[model samples]
Every structure is written in C-alpha cells, then in structure tokens.
Target chain A: MEHPGEGTRNGGSFVVSCESVSFSYPGSGRPALSDVSFELRPGEYVGVVGPNGGGKSTLVRLLNGLLKPDSGRVLVSGRDPATEPFEVRKHLGILFQDPENGLVAPFVEDDVAFGLENLGVPRKEMRDRVAGAIRAVGLEGFERREPDTLSGGEKQRVALAGLLAVEPDILVLDEPTSMLDAAGRREVLAYLETLRAEKTVLHVTHHLEELVRSDRILVLNGGELVADKTPERFLSDADLLRENRLVLPVVQRLALEIGLSPARLRTPETLAEAILAKTESGTRAG
Target chain B: MRLELRDVRYVYAPGTPFEVEALRGVSLVVEPGEVLGIVGGTGSGKSTLVQHMNLLLTPTGGEVLVDGVDATTLKKSELRRRVGLVFQFPESALFAPTVEEDVAFAPRQLGLDEEEVQERVLESLRALEAGELAARSPFALSGGEKRRAAIAGVLAMKPEVLVLDEPTAGLDPATREDLLALILGLRNAGISVVLVSHDLDEVAEVADRVCALQEGRVRAIGTPAEVFYREPAQAPATVRVASLLRESKPEIGAPVRFAETLDALRALQGA
Candidate 1:
C-alpha cells in the first residue's frame, strides 16, 4: 500500500493526527493502543489492518476521542480530539463494527435521525437530512421498519446511514461486516467504494484482501504502526509480514514465491499472474 | 478412526413463520490424520456444518459419529474431550487472569490432577510456542499470542478432533498464515482437523478433503483438487489455474491444491 500522508503538500494539512498516542483502559496494565501516529487528508480512504489485539479497534476509538489516549495526542480536524472532542466529532463520522451497538432507535428512520437531532439541527432540516441519509444508504422503504426485523447486513447499512446523516467530512468504520456472511461483506465493501468518493474513509479490518481498494494501508503490530505501504506493496511484502506473524494475501505470496515480476503484483490480479508465471517457469522448487 | 456424519439436518425457529433450515441431509466422513476443509458463502450453512463437528449444536435430523460412536448420544463431558472448537477470534473466549490459568481451565474443569493439568498446559503452550507466557495476564498478550493461548486452552483437553470455525476469517495476512501452519501441523500429528472457511486459498493449503455447503445442503465433496474446480467452483485464483491447465491438457483430472508448484502449473498448461 502506498504510505498515506506521504508526498502530499504540507500546507493546510491533516484532517486527523496522532502523535505517539497510547491508551489503557481503567485498572488494566495493558494498553489497547500504544505509541501510534498517522495523519489523514480530507477524503483519503485508508485501511487499518493488523493481527488481533494490535490496537485496530483502539485506533478507531482514538480517531473520535471516545477513549482519550493516555500518553499522547489525537487531533481531529486540526483540533485535539481529547480537548475539543465535541468540535472534532462534529466534523467526523464513525461506524463501529457492531451495528447492534449503533442502532438504538426502535425504527430505522428514527435511528437515522438521532444524530442530526443530537447536533441540535432544526427539526424541519433534520427531516430533510434523515430522508437524504436513508436514501443514500438504499434504505428508503425500510425507514419505518423495526431494526430487529432487518438482516445483519441491512442493520449495518442502517448504521452507515446514521453516520452519513451527520454529514461529517470523514467516515471511519470498524469491521462492520464481521457478523455478515461473504455476500454481506461484499455489499458493505461495494458501498464503501461509492462513499469514499464523497469523503475520507478509514476502514479498520484485519482482512488484508478486503482492503485492496484502500488508497493506503496502515499495518499495526503490537500496537505500533509497523508497515505503512500501498495495499499492493504491503500485501506483497511476505517476508516482512511473516516476521510479525501476519499473512499476506495468498495470491501475492504465491506470486513472489514463484518469481513473478514484481510489476505484475497487483491486488487480486497479482495472484493470477504469480501462479501463471510460476507454472510457465516449471520451477516447483520452492 | 474417522469422524462421520450421517443424515444430519438442523432447523432454526422451528414451527414458526421464520423457521428455516440451517443444514439438511448432510452425510460426510472425515478421516483421522486428515485436514478436512468446509467452504461456502455466508448463510450457505458453513457455520452450521462446523458447529455440528464439535457438538456445539445438536442436529435435528442426523447423527454425528466420532470413531463410529454417535456424538449426539455422548455425554457432555465425553463430547468435550473428543472435539475442541475454536471460534474465529479465539481471544474473545479468554477470561482468565493469566495465560497459564486460561490454558489450564478446560483440563482442570475435567478434574485432572494439578500435576496432570500443569503438564498438559505447559505442553500445549509449548506446542503453540507460548510456554513463556505462563504468568502474563492473557489480556496483556499481543493479538497473535492471545489466539495461541486460546488454542492452548483447547489443546489441554487433548481433543482427538480439533475444529476451527473460520480460524483466519478476518486476520492480517501474516497472522493468518501462522495459524494455518499450526493447524496443518496438528493434522500431521494424527489429529482429525475440520477447518471451516470461505477463503479457498487457506482451505487449499491445509485441507486434505474439501466440501462446499450451499443453502442448507451439501453441494460438493472431494479432495481439494477434485472440488477446487471439478464440480462446484472455488476461488477465482484456483478456478483460473484449473481452467488454464484443463485447456492445455484435459488429463490433469482435477486441480491439485497441495502441489501448487510452478512446474505443476506449467505441466498442467502443456509446457
């Protein structure tokens, strides 16, 4: 993955920044996040991935100041989320991994309208925003339906609608598809591609294959930002990832193992090229 | 000995408007010392199929046999000793104060003596390469380490059959591979392993037999090579590789997973 925040102009900078951010929940010696740092531009789609307990979830919470960093700083929209959290939250939207956690309203439309109402938007304007959000998430007809009746995938879409209703400048999600089946995961990902066009997106997941479309990838290991590369390079770095007990996508690893040209290594595509290249070379020695 | 299922069927919300079949008329056999892979998209019954292997769920219409004994008829304690089930994120199941305690809980629960429990706990941790973590609080361990500790917990029971339900479902690439290798090692050690996953690449790497479940029914069953492309389709990579080989020479019979060498691919392509 191309390292995000690199090679961009430094002027009028980062939407979010973390300087050695470390966090520990109360009464526990272990920290959920430790010594992490990164920056995001206005509309960049960044994928955060790592082994379990590498602080992926914690990183997501830090973005919104839900859990303040115990050691360092987390700034959202150029303001410290730890201090001016209300100000920071106003500009950013976050969708947690669990849709059940976000859907507090009895009805889908009421749920979508919760955030706008909380922000003190005028009642008349809130209705318009709720309608727009529901339509955006492809749930126009289900607005009045009880959330309990929705499938896990639909519930997640409703959660996304809730975030979109806020009309924040950026969106962050944490494994929203974990509870869904394969098809559900696909729908969520497909939706994200469109959403990315309108605002910055940071999707936190451990599944590297699912992150192929992300503009940049931030890999965490032991709560540290270890490898920040473009999705292509990051997945292709088999040796480096192995040292940290991470798996690169199978296709990329097979390609590198079989001696395919590094140039042929692209997400999903590199997989085929690698296998084909090796087969033609007839060197099954590895 | 083999773990076999005979005419297994399961239903959800029975006798209600939303009643649905999760698995149906599934008959299968898994040989000891073999790694059997189960693949299917979501709601295709993959999860339901795996839950049966460990007796986590009772089949409404079938019998699960381990070593020719019906699992459904076994006592709860007996079933726990025969099959160890690991969910996707095993760490979510951890709750002990220290790694040693977590790993020992299951065996200790079985009423093993302290010496026996401690010995098995240490051996299991060593097998997972986590023996040094004895005193550390499990919550303090890293992500990968926590997963290993969970596996160790299951291993302490000395289950003859270990079932991992989507073991690497949402893990980083490196961590996924590390766990896969460990699973492969367990199978090689003569433990019957059943791996349920959607990632065809992973199933290809470790499974001796691969079965696909589609909509509460068994859709396909065979060796990885046989099922990779012969009947139901596999992942895009496996499918492409199989297609190329079949086009070059039709005699390759089916796609072979374990031997994914370049020479094999070239040979399949009539080079």
Candidate 2:
C-alpha cells in the first residue's frame, strides 16, 4: 500500500490517482492548484479541507473531468478523467453543496429518475432503481412531493438519491451540508456514514468535526497538498492545523485545555467518559 | 434603533392553493447595540423573520415597531436605510462593474451627495477590511474577499440594525472567525446586529441572546445558555460536551460559550 504524503510514488491499486497535478484559471497570475497529488483506494473515506482559495473545489472539478489539469495526469480507475470524460463519470458521481444545482425535475421521483433515464436504463429497471435510491435516503414516502416544497435537508437527500440511482462506484461531495441547519447537517452526515462501506467517498468540507470519522484527512493550502494524515494525527497536531488555517472543534479544543489528548477525546461522549474516569481515580488517590 | 416584532405573522401565496404560513405569531426584539442570534432548522422561518426586520416582507398579522413607531408608517426607503437586510449569498447581489461602485449603490440610492457616497463607500470597505479591493472587479476577487465586498454594500447604507443571514455559510475556519470578530466589533461600535444562522457554535460565541424557532413559531428565546442548555440535543459542541459531563457530575453549572465551558471543565478538576 502507498503511504500518506508519498502520492508521487504511485503504482498501487487506487480507485483515484493524481500525479503532480497543477491547474490554473485563465488570465490568473497564480495557479489555482499547484503540484497536488493524492490517491484514494476503494472504499476510502477521504476528507478534503482548506481555506477559500485553496483549490479544494478545483481539485474536485479535476477529478470529474470538468476542469483539465494544466500539467500531469488524473486517473479515475486507471482511465484519465481529462481524456476519457464519459468513462470517468461512469465510475464517479459528484454532489455539490446546493442541491438546487443538481435537481432538474419538479417531482422528487422524477428528479431521482433523471440520471437513470439519461443512461437509457429500461423502464422496469429504472422504476426499481429509483425506489431503491429513495429508500436509501429514507425518502420513501415523499416520492410525489415537489422539490421546491421540501426543506433544505430533504432537497439534499433527494439529490443524493439521484446520484445513488446511477450506481456510481465513487461519490465526491463538495460541502454537501454547509447550507443545512444543525438537525439537517446531522441527517446528511448520518447518511454519509452508511455510504462508507460500499463507496469510495471524497468529502470536502470546512467543518473539522465532520472529518473525525474519515479514513484520511487531506489539507490543501495555496493550491498545494500540504498534509495527508489520518483524522487522529491531524487533530493531535496543533501546529499543522494552525498552519493550514484550521481550528479544532469546540469539544476537541476543550480536551486540549483540560490536558487530555484531543485526538482520543474527539467526540463528546468519549471526552466525557475520559473526564469521569480521570476524576474518579483522582478522588480515590486524594 | 430598537426593533420589535409583536406577534408577527407572514403567509406566502395567500388566497391560493400554495398558501403557506411561513411565520406564525413570532415575537422578538433587537435591543440597541446588542447581538441577537436567530437559530432554527430548515423551514423554521428564520429567513422570513429577518425579512420582517427590514420590512422586505410585511407581516400578515401583528405590528412591527421600530423604536415604538410603527414600521409600516415609515417610508419604505427610510425604513430600509435604517434596517439594512443582507440577504443570504449577499455576494450574488453585487452587480456593479467594480467593488467601489457596488458598495456605493445603496448610499447613492439614499439620495446622498456624490462626496458623501464616495466617503461611505471607502469607509464601509475599510470597515470590512476590504479597502485594498475597492478598485478590483467583484467577480475577480476571492470568495472571502467577495463576501466582505458584498457586506460592504450593506454597511455603506449605515443602517441602525444590521441583519445578516448565514454570513459564514461556506467560509473556512479562519475567515469565519474573522467575520465573527467583525460582527462583534460592529456591535461594539453601537450597531445592533441580528445574526441569523444555523451555526450553533458561532451563535454561542458572539450572541448576547439567542432565539430558537420551530415550524414557524418561536420555540425559545433567552441567553445562549438558557436556550441551548435547555435543548441539549441542539446545543453547541461546547455546551453539548458540558451537558454530557453534567450527567455524571450534576454540580456543574450551565456553560454556553467556549471560555465558560473550559472554566467549567477546569472547576471539575478542582484546579
């Protein structure tokens, strides 16, 4: 297996691979992405994070053939995404932040079926796939509801259903829950956990808490892949996080203040449990 | 200015099949120079409620009062000038060829003289820390720069009450912190801020008071600790962690903000 931060040494069975990819927008003096490299194995839940102009979105566009890298190669399942656009799309699906951007139909059912219909799936199979997709997102009863009438969280789920119906092997989500509220964000994040076992997921987000469960976290800065580490390692390094302009979540920050390892006490439950254990032992010793 | 909504109600598409009650008897107030946070889930009428602050949407029932005067009686422009409404994605509303012209649009429409408009444009851009970007094209600026330039458009109006809808939606951690600091600084300068967002942690950090909405109705309105502590499921991460600790140690008091939570945890260690 290839090690983290060693993406230049390729030659592994990776579902997605980028070899020293560099891209720049037209008329722009600075490159949007510079010498970025990463690899994603199948069923890998990788989280991408950085500042506003840090090329997170540019990297996502490159993976789906929307933007061609100015130099180097981008391979999805061994096929170059820039040259074989259709082939790359067959194995990958992208879900942007605004669900409104992806929804094309008035009715939820029809919107979910749009991808399958475009692929020329038979009517009988399309119906089954649409139902299955809707069920996967827990929208089984809202098939006839209009997209405009749904809540922000519901609309996002419908968009995911649309992508799931296509049966793509890889799912790349770009801030899928940023527009959502606390409850809505919980809903989408919970659904993403269900996707971890079957799909190679690349989730880009500004919320560090969302990356806690990720298999690997990639930090991008000034269009460069600055750091590639697991969530625990990433959270434990205060300097690395600060260099990338990231701050720990409130719970993790509390752990740091209480002289506890922020990585192990990442979540509220675990932190609370650890605190209780420490206090109980202290009470006996004192 | 002190803004008050007494049992405000708004219905979309009234007298039609699509009619829906967006705000149902919502009542609140924005005291002068204080930061009030409005929090809710989707379809909870947070956006609709903020629209009433600037009179973008007239209440179907009940009165909106600005400093004890009925808001409806004031000229629309006068009311708009006093209560600037920064819509969600305010950057999308920046249409002028340059950032300077965009920030100047509101003041110019206020019938201010040319010199006054120019002064407000520069002052507002500086207030948002975007003075260097005044000559740049809005489309050419970075996402954070564009967001600040757009907010400058509203700031140029010199509204008494500034209502921002999800100001930090897509911003990264550092930029989000900067915006929050800017908001607090504005409140310090005597402008009442109505921060409407889904970001619970941010609300807890800056808000003097918190308001919660549910299904077009006011569910709770109090200090951040009062509202968030009462609803543990919806509390900010720090408050949630504190609540988790309280289950085992009931002596711990309610702590809403980060510093308060840290203090509470420190007290637990008896340090």
Candidate 3:
C-alpha cells in the first residue's frame, strides 16, 4: 500500500505541503486564499470544511496544479506542482463537486480505463485495472451502461472508479456527495471508508457531520486558515464554528443545548442510547 | 391561491425509442398560505410535478387546477405570472448584465409600466435581503447572493403560488438557514409555497405538510411528524434518533426537529 513516491518528501512523511500559499481570481477585489499553509502526511484523512466562497475549491485546485498559487509555493512529493504538473497529476486523483464534469467517456468501463489508457498501460493490464476499480465501487455489472443512464450517485461512483483505476496515491474529493440523496451519500461514504487504509484522502465538504470521523480537520474562512485540529477539538468550539459561517451538526447542537456532552453523542445511535440511559436512570430514581 | 394536480401524468419523448414516464397519476394540493414540501429520491418526478404548476409543462393525461379553474384553459403568460416556478440552480439562468435588470425582466414583460416595474424590482430585492446587490452584475455575485437575486426575479412577478425546485441544493449552512427563513416569511405574507427538496431536515423544519414521491408515484403525504416518522430510512436524523429511542422507551414522541427531539427526551426523563 506504500506510495511509490513516498520517501521522496519530508523524510517520507508528508505527501503534500503548502507553504504560505495565496491566490486570487482575476478581477476579484479580494484574494480567494491568503497565506494558507498546511501539510498532509501519508495515509492521513484530512477534512477541509468552510462556507461557500471560503477558498476550499481554490485550495483543492492548487493541490493538483489545476490552478497555480499567486504567491508562495505548493509541493507534492517534494516537487513543485507549478513546475512538475505532470508528475504531481500522476500521483493525485481529484474528484470535483460535479461528477458530470469528470466523466468523459460514454460507457462506464471505458471511462474507468480512460486514465489508464492515457498512462499507456497495456491492454490486458488496463482491463484488469478497470474491472477491479469498478468492482471496488460496486459497479461491476454496469460496465457497458452509458454514463448518462446512471443516477447521480452511480455517476459519482463511476467517477471514483475512474480515479481508482489509475491507483493514485493522493485522492482529493471536493463535495463528492453533495448532490446525492441520503442513501447515495451513505453508499459513497462507505466506499471512502474502505479507501482510508491505502490512500491519503483530502475530503472537502460543507457538511460538518461528514467531518466528524476524520483524523484531522482544516477549517478555512474568508481565504484564511483559521483552525487546524483534530475533529473532536474542532467540533467542540461552537462559537468558532458559527463565526466561520458553519453550523454544528444537529445531534451535536442538541446535545450541547440539553446539557449533555456532545462528544458522547457524536452519532444518532449514541444519542439514542444516551437518551434511553437517562430515561432508565431517571425512572429508577423515581 | 390554491393549486392542485388531478391524476397528473407526464411522459417525456412520447412515442419515441427513448420515451420515459416521469410522472404517473401523481396528485397533490397546495393550500393557500401553506408550505407544502415535496420529498423524493432522484428521478422521482419532483421537478416534472412542479413544472405543471406554472403551465411550463402540459400533462399528457391529466389536469392542473388553480383555485378551481382549469390551468390549461388559462393564458400561458397569466398563469406564469400567477404561479412562479423557480428551477433548480435558478442562478445559472441569470443572463441580464445587472441584478436589477434581471429581476425587472419579468415584471416588464408582463406589461407593467416602467415606474411600476422599478418598484417591483426594488421590492423583490428588499424582500430577499439583496437590495444592496441591485446594480452588481449577476455574474459578479457569490453563489448565495446569486441565488437570492434569482429568487428576487421570481418574487418581482408577484406570484400567488411559488414553486421552488431544490432551491437550497448547493447553499452553505448559514445561507441555507437564511433561505429557509425567507421561505417562511413569504408563506406568512400569504404566498403559498411548494418546496421540492432532498434535505429532509430542511423540509421538516419549514413544511406544514410533506409528500413523499417514489418512482413517479405519491408514496406518502401527511404532517412532518406523520410522514417523516413513517419510514426510518427516509426520516431526518432527529426523527431517526427519536425512533431509535422509542424502541426502548415507548413514551418518547416522534420529534422531527432538533429542539422538539431534545424537549421530548427531557420530558421522558422528567416523568
């Protein structure tokens, strides 16, 4: 599961690094990102969260060299993305907010093989890789189905399979499940959990609940890196979250409001258990 | 101000190889001054159902009635003005150079005088809290601001019934809260609203009643507590949590909102 380019950067620990990076869109009065710096270690799950227009998309684009920083530097595996764009892209697989934008080929299997074909993989190896990737995303029987015929969630899975076919080291997903329903969201998230052991995932989302399980969270606000901490520390600060235009998850907020510790009620199951425990203890005392 | 669909059915590309039935005998009613939330999975015909409200799409084998009058017999322009339909990602439809011009387009096209059109435009902008963005180009506004401006364009038409298709699809949390509040305000001001959304929590918060659509059919329709609590898989997180607790503690009620769920749990503990 080790990355081929692992030991080439920061003593083989950090896979991606941003040093005082700043960027502004053309004609924009304010910078989209300013003096933002962070580093991702190998196989670490980092969640990037902020409000709309909070420079999240900008940061993801910077990571893959799709958009170069206006100032400072961005490095992937000890190589600058601006200078070594091809090398950076070879190791990075980015899924954008809209799956339609990433899906180019008409058929599902062909789309998964597009990147492998670009890398000039042998025909036999490409077929095997495509089959494995599709199976990984649970889209095995949909090889010949047209991309347009798939549902929103299926289309996103197809896009993920396309990313996995290349076997990239770093996976950057920007709001990958934003357009999906509850079932679809769970489907995509379940697959992402399986990927945690092998790949470094940088998930950018507006849903604070989605970040509750991440190893670390990077909070952005008004083009600034406002907070960098574990998910527990980040979720505990209600005022900070509100100030950054984010709302606490419903369960967390309910726990905080009802004099219960939010940390103990991170999920709906736990929240239900806590309530039942309280009811039983209260009845026994009565 | 009431709108109803009578066994409405719509088929896309009828009699062709790619034909598909989007809506199948789906019927619902929106009472005056009430918020009717429509919940469904993807391709459940929520958008197709709303399009029939404004006469944008004619039902292949059914009738749309507004205040007991057959909508098909009504003038298309008049029906459009009376029933404003806001499509998904309406901001992407903004084409005018400036926000004011975009908002003013509908009122002017309705043959309102220049002064009246200006008044309507300003009023709609103020209604959505976007008056400050009047002169800015629609292209220049942020995602939230652009959404408000697009809604203002529809509000300028002064529709009696407003149908929104996934209005809060890509909005951030704070922006989403603001937009929900705006929808409530519109309902309080006597405008009936039909909200089609996938966010169950949002629907639970603002909807007076909710209808569930599955595979182009009406699956369930009732108050938020009744409809949301009926199916654990489709319920909001708060209701699902309540349902889970109810298995062990039967006294706890089905609470759809966070505040209500907390209060219900506290009451159970107190008793």
Best by lDDT: 2
Per-model tally of clashing residue pairs? 15, 0, 0
Candidates ranked by TM-score:
2, 3, 1
What local lDDT does model 3 show for residue A46? 92
| lDDT value for model 2 | 0.87
Instruction: TM-score for candidate 2, please give it.
Output: 0.93
CAPRI classification of candidate 1:
acceptable
lDDT of all the models against the reference? 0.74, 0.87, 0.85
Model 2 spans > 4 angstroms off: A1-14, A139-145, A149-151, B15-17
| Best TM-score among the predictions, by candidate number | 2
Please give the TM-score of chain B in predicted model 3.
0.97
Q: In model 1, what lDDT does residue B60 have?
A: 90
Q: How would the candidate models be sorted by DockQ, starting from the highest? A: 2, 3, 1
Screening candidate 2 with a backbone cut-off below 3 angstroms (N, C-alpha, C), the clashing residue pairs are none
Which regions of candidate 3 deviate over 4 angstroms?
A: A1-14, A84-86, A100-117, A122-155, B13-19
| Candidate 2 vs 3: which has more lDDT | 2
DockQ for every model, please: 0.28, 0.64, 0.51
Local error of candidate 1 at B252, Å? 6.8
